[model samples]
Target chain A: MQAGGLPDTNQVSTDPLRNEVPVTALGEASVETPTRAQALLRKIEPYLYLLPALLLVGGLLLYSVAHTLAISFTDWDLITPPRFVGLQNYIDAVRDPTFTRSFTNTLVWTGGSLLLPVGGGLLLAVVLERIPGQRVLKTLIYLPAILSTTVVAAIWSYVYTNNGVLNETLRWAGLDALARPWLVFAPTNTLAMIVASSWRALGPSMVLFLVGLQTIPPELIEAAKIDGAGERILFWRIKLPLLRPITAVVVIMSVIGSFMTFDLVWVMTQGGPGRSSETLAVTMYRQAFIMWRMGYAGAVAVILSAIVIVFSISYLRATLKRSAL
Target chain B: MKRYSNAFWPLLVALLLVPALLMGGSIAAQDDPVVIDWANDAAWHEAGQDAVGEASLGVTGIGVNTVIFTSTDTYQAAVRGALPTDDAFPLFDWWFGYRMKDLVDAGLLADVTDIWQGHIDKGEYPASMMGSFGFDGRAYGLPKMINYWVVFYNKHVFAENGLEVPTTWDELMAVAEALKSNGVTPFGLDVVGCRWCSFIWFEEMMVRVDPALYQSVMSGETAYNDPQVVAIMEQWRDLLDAGYFSQPGDFSDNWEAPFVNGDFGMYLIGDWWTGSLERAGFVAGEDYGVFVMPGITEAGNRSLIIEGRPLLIAANSPQLDVALEFADYFMSVEAQTVWAETSDINSPNLLAPEETRPGHLVDLANAVANGEYELYTRYWEATPPQIVEQVVDLLGQFVLDPAALQTVLDGAEQIAQDYWASAGGE
Candidate 1:
């Protein structure tokens, strides 16, 4: 009934079709609703059509977000009803060394996840564009994308195992010392997982870059060639700038994927060699599900969600500006 | 409009009958069988399906749905999520010990005491196993199998190297030094990234130190930083530093390759590997053999670690009636013989005579029957799940680098203290 500050809906004509033709009322041409009930119906008709859908989507989303935020302030195992302990969960998370390690690892994961996939994808897209067996190369590289995360993790971990493919290759080449257990130690452990994930991620990113590459007109490249511009100059000055928008999207997706990563890391190392390879997502899952500390887990989830939102907003703003240009 | 109304009546009738038709169809389907869902790890999917099929053979109007997950961790994760809901499977497989008790306390498990008591009355299972699956005199699960840890050595290799099954620490060490001197890896300690199995030698070393201490430690009565625990670490460090172990990889089934080729000599692993060793083409009691791990001294204590897998029924399942029927059949001697043959496991069913089981399995069964060794539950499932998860990593790390023993042990102590404190120092 309050309708906020919306314009005078009380004047709405229930007989919308009939009211478009002006009726002479009290010496002036004006529209009129014969009844208050009819006017009210007209005012609320659009809302009636929209209410079901809005309640379905908006209500669900609002409840989920509010519930998550509320849980972040409490201490609950998944089995027990949450008990209010405002700010304690957050404070504990801040002081926990494991959380700190997980955060740092998450940053490392995000950085690697973005740079390698995006860079490799762009390079592959350009190189394959001119190559003869382009279809085959792209198909082979992209095939991993169709495989499930479980399959990819399984295959890659086998490759990284002590006597697995990589080590065997090194041994066959007589470089025995070069083949350390790629997944058993830190820095190397995280890097190895990144390589595996990048393999699976590179395909879709390349497809996006390929689409962006198609948007560049051939005449520009021909013109650059006529001006004695080399391939490096052509890419650095013209093509690279043109690809920024697609690149931003790929980078953002990769970063988001890194922040939300759980499957491959879990399959490969289970975030161990003593939590050395744990990203925030893995740590959060271990706390909530494995350790049964749902509230603390919720706090970590909020922190992760905040990081993702901030990055997404900044990237989206820049992308929008770039598109506008 | 007149013609359309004529058509509309038939359509309306059909639409109205849809619900009735569905109800009738579901009723017809229900007449086919009562469905019992069995959730377990995919590693045993075929075995489980086979066992269920064999068990269901004389029973009528029953069908079992086997839902197998790829791994234990993922399966446990899914089970935990599903436990609080009515949509959970009626029957699932899990490790028994403190974990079972935890669920029993949480009121998540069904009271399977009737089936358990029936099995005992039939003398199908031993009292000890029933004890494992129960707390406060109410059983929650049925024991599937127990895997006894023993030192499996290549009989041919041992014969060729002029070595005997060592029965004391001195002889074991001398044999290991001899194997190393001969350029053969003495023990296959390969557990690259896998958990739970990495603690085999750790358990061996602990029980060797003092079985009572090991039991107390598992119960949280003894701390990880205890001097006896420190002694276990020092001894483990000495053995590891001697370069007596094989090149440790993620050796799941690949262990066969080195064992057959004689590059790997002995492995103090669970009886679960009996099947794998057979698969590796080793003739039991001829080409390969099992020996109890030697005691620490010439005259001292010795113990046997018994690891069992249990099948539980979810309390919230609507199909619990059918599931209980299935579980009863699963625990029978008739079912267990087929189960033992099909899955190549030593089922703990006492009614399944020793003569019917595999030779290597019969050996341990006889030992248990003779009361030749003291029994202790496996440390992996005997203690708290969280503590096991934390310490297994540290134990695995110690295998990689023995110098970190003290640091790892101290860290384990801190984790234990924190966990137990938050658990109200249980």
Candidate 2:
């Protein structure tokens, strides 16, 4: 009957005298009993219900992804006969300077995004949980999460433009000399895009952490306080450790999202100012769609998937180890 | 697993039923019409759609369904993705050469050569525009519209700044310097979002310097980083450094914005840009005038980069005969006239009557007829796709750092050499 526990059987029974109802009638109830063949049919009925959906989704995933992998090994251009090229696509990708740049950009993007959003979200969640009007603050902070990424990118593109709102505001506040083409400049473009990415990413992490924060019992914190813990000590020693699992989830999600950062770059820069802003995903898209080199693109995609899988596995393993400790 | 069974069944059943219902609904919806899917570029303004709607009223025997995509990049991607499937649009506008070759080689494009030959024998469209649709002496598409780059300058801006249309390199430099000194940006070049814009400048310069050299580079006859190319890069860099461009880093800014605002003097863009400019509330011949790009060589010849949008029929389309008939009708003078008047696009059919021409289109026709133009296919359409990307990216980088001219040129040369070797080029 408690919120966290399973439902009580006592609540289902109206009276103790109802237990005298015939056992044979209960067995014969349409919801309960069947013959041997019917029981076997009943046992497999759920599987029958699920068969079409399983086949549809499973067949699609297998055909598309497996077909893509097979195409990656050939010299298919989405048009011509797919000549078997072995590992040429993979080899070419490694040798490509643009591909190398894209790879490095994705790494920086993934690492930087994970740190900012997950860390900031945790910090904000801990602080905001105790603040007055926490619900209002939570709603305000989480609003951007519900907006489409296209809308977010459009707003951020204007802010990042040369004479845009960001620069205009900076200039008015006596930062005139610091203003430059934010998204056009080489080393700064990636950083600028990452900032925009973090803004959109912050909301989801904050919400996740808020939910995680609520699950940590008030009694634990009270006990920590009674044990003579200061605010800083309580946070670092108690709250932080308790929020570790959620933080791991947030970080892994952020990493994957950052690695696949395409829309923001596509809408804003289109991988421009000379390929400085291209991620591996953008490169894959260009090779696949723009150039119609499907095989090469497939190779890039396979490599990207491998990287994501590795990162996710290592993250899970580390999270598990930390939780065990 | 048994403990979770209660939670799992309802969720599973709901998920399973939703798709089944949707599939049934779609199947039921398809029984009423002969759907012909026609895909068009985003650049085709609403007027084109209106014209199509009007035109389709005349063909009541056929039921047509048009899916218009606004983004050229997305449209191309969709067409490529849909090729292996039965669901690709029955007809679509595709760029010539590379796009046509790829589609034809894949056996995805219907051979519309017979239709084209029939049109040609009837003297419907120009033979030159047929160059775009033809690959290895076979036609796969019908050229719907033709476009070529011309130097479009603001006459008011030029007159106010006491500058004439430059016909030579020296005059262009002088005009640019004068404009810069007077606090006006000389040109509006959108080099930020598209590397293709920068390539236009590169090719324009290359053609002016030596058309043969440009063709050699495009056809892999010469290295992309050759001395001639380096010179062209140096010239481009010099122009940028001299303040010929309005805003170098503002690549996201539409070229027409600065031009329309009367802050920039000129825009080197294709004829198709006139539609966008008109949409932005600018008039041609009154506010702006078209001129030939200046000559870098002694010949004083003008070469315009031609890009054609060809309407192609899908090979596997069940309605192939209907599609060809529609295509033949689409390329006729009557249809082209409708296209030119309504969409404000230049028709490849030379017979498009002058009476039906839009204001700027009339001017374009005049310019082409006066022997002031020669059609040169866009480098993107002419060159290998990888080479196009490499060249464009290098040009964009050069715009940022003029000092990186040699390095960019060298990089392009390396890519060109590699491409040539791989492609078995002579």
Candidate 3:
């Protein structure tokens, strides 16, 4: 009677356990069960949340890239039927001396902007770390960045004019021999424009570097000091290695911005002094809007985008690899 | 994929939402009155608005939304961008050939031939004035004003220097050399606005070489670097090197002010410049005098470069009847006289009331009728936009560095050849 009672109890417990089931059996049964609204919601909730942004960004990317690419294939003047010309536009662009000059100008501009502004910013951020009144100085340095590009161009135009403040100051200081039409003279015209660009760009990179500098732990510096590392060694090994991500971001942004530069050059130079200062973007605008050659201009735009994308991808890859290391 | 899924529907909705909103707005706009937007240079704002209002009131009895577009450059760009869309201004000021041809080719310009012919038969305007606005024997626009580029020298400066207006090329260069020696730049030029100043030089050179060649070159019949053209460019280079010309600076600098203030000896510009000079407190004939530019050849052929500004109607506009009616009313003697009086512009309508014109303008108008002249379409109007830009930029560069004369000329020739080839040759 006692053994039968134990077996009966086990059977009763086993009934509940059978209903509950093993984890694997439960998983299998759930697959066959008509999923509840709550279960479906659980499955799709994340997707529902992401759907809007994905469609938005995807649509924009598709429209811009596709429209530009399509335009490159057709000789549409914006006022006429788009004549399909296949690869003729690309061939014409390659043959154009102006396009060649613009490509060179873009490369020089990107290289110059990166080396000068980013280098200057890193040096400035390091120096500013120990300097007092940096907050005020930083504000002062950033003032030019706050001004609109047009305003900067206007002020700089006057400064670069033959009879303007720059020449006036040089003449007053007995450097009259150095004074010339700074904006009209070749080689100097390109340099003068770059200087104006650098003035506007310096503060942003400086600010970025300052933020990067702060993210660096004080303990690392103290540890380097304990290891008898000099200030230069601490900066080169500890600080710079840690700041690689920010440096990469600054360099990449400056490169892209330099390639896309148009407004300042348009306002100040109009890609003139015999198209000496014409960049790829300006030439593209002239061809597309002014000359009404949409297909050729689109080809130029595509080439520019490819160049910039290549630079961005390379930079990102290098950054990621460095971070991994 | 999971990350994108959450955003996909919302983004699709938003993407669908924007265009819908824009379409809704556009449809709403359509239900409203057919609003006609008009624009022009700020300098002519008041006169333009008055003319537009008078024309619109007399015809459609509805006011147009007139925006005074600032800066000629900006106005050109805005009109260019808007012309491709159906939202272009119904009527706007445009030069002939360059922009007009593009518009006409695109069928964007309303055929105002019937209206123009009606005005022509009524003897309201001269047939000669229509030459600029007509292409393929059809008029697409109405000429509002005709101006001749005459040399305007400061009478006070010329008298002070004991110089009379030169009548020949040799005498003109002599005056220029003398003016330079006297520490006064012989010419007042705004070369920064490349087309504005360079156009005068181009016209003068073309006239000097051969009037036929000028027409032939502009009509794509002749090369730009012909021996005769090269000779003219060399002469221009010599002038540039001699420092007889004003420095190319900001175009907005008071180019005429230096001439009026006795800082320079002469200024070659359109007769419309007299209005600006007068407004600046300089009296015509007393402070300045207009004369034909000296001839380059001993044949004593004196010629003036004439240009016209015309008003054009958009082709696709639903209000075509109203637009033509407005054009006719605008060309009427009463309106032309009103514009001439207020703006100091020479109305193309020959019947412009004498009382409405300023005394100096009346004299200039009479000169235009009697003078032996070649109507010079704005340089860009005669050339493709690409060639025009290249030529102007090259001219500016030459002004900066005169040593690039041959290179600039060669480049211009190449551009001209390419342009002609593209146009299927003359």
CAPRI classification of candidate 1: incorrect
TM for candidate 3 is 0.84
Q: What is the DockQ of candidate 1?
A: 0.22
Docking band of candidate 3: incorrect
Tens-digit lDDT track of model 1 for B292-329: 88878432245888887888998878887777888888
The residue ranges of model 1 lying beyond 4 angstroms of the native Cα positions read A1-88, A127-140, A143-146, A168-177, A225-228, A322-325, B1-36, B42-65, B70-74, B81-88, B111-124, B136-138, B248-263, B277-283, B297-301, B316-330
- Structural similarity to truth (TM-score) of each candidate: 0.83, 0.87, 0.84
Candidate 2, which segments miss by more than 4 Å at Cα? A1-34, A60-62, A132-137, B1-35, B43-64, B70-74, B81-88, B117-124, B167-169, B251-253, B298-300
Candidate 1 — what's its lDDT? Answer: 0.80
User: In candidate 2 chain B, what residue range of length 10 has the lowest lDDT sum?
Assistant: B56-65
Best by lDDT: 1
Report the error of model 1 at residue B379, Å. 1.5
User: What interface RMSD does candidate 3 have?
Assistant: 5.9
Query: In candidate 3, what are the lDDT values of residues A135-163, reduced to their tens digit?
Result: 89888878899989988887888788766
What do the candidate models score in CA lDDT, each in turn? 0.80, 0.77, 0.76
State the DockQ of every prediction. Answer: 0.22, 0.32, 0.22
